[model samples]
Target: MIFCIKLPGGLIKWCRVINFKESASGENPGNLKTPSCFLPSSKEPVRFNLYTDFIPLQKIVTNPNLSL
Candidate 1:
């Protein structure tokens, strides 16, 4: 899952949870602990719409693997 977290200096940044480790012997069995692998976004933030600015229309049409 992607999250927008505020840092100590009140800066907002994007990060993604790569792994979810479940807590053992806890009150809730299905409860999840902190993310084992948290990956920060490397790319710069976009100002416009992602679909229009980030991805090219030509690539989207030619690349069959690309999905909306």
Candidate 2:
């Protein structure tokens, strides 16, 4: 699954998710993970639950009025 984070000032970021079972069984750990620059600090972690299918990149790129 891909995750899109809406940051302050309306910036968008995307990342692909890796299930732990897949990673534990030796899937490409680095490839499936979010880039280090996208991660929050350990001292003030951000957390949330995903409840919907991922938003497609095309929709985001093509539409100017969509809001999460």
lDDT of each: 0.46, 0.48
Model 1, residue 35: what's the lDDT? 32
Residue 46 C-alpha lDDT in model 1: 24
| Residue 24 CA displacement from its true place in model 2, Å | 12
With a 3 Å backbone cut-off (N, CA, C), the pairs that clash in candidate 1 are: none
Once model 1 is optimally superposed onto the true structure by TM-score, how far is the C-alpha of residue 53 displaced, in angstroms?
35
lDDT of 1 by residue, 1-68 (tens): 45565555567876644333233234444433433233344343322222243577788889969985
Q: Tell me the deviation in Å of residue 60 in model 1.
A: 43
Give the poorly placed runs of model 2, Cα more than 4 Å off. Answer: 20-45, 48-68
For every model shown, the clashing-pair count is 0, 0
Model 2: number of clashes?
0
- TM-score, one value per model: 0.28, 0.30
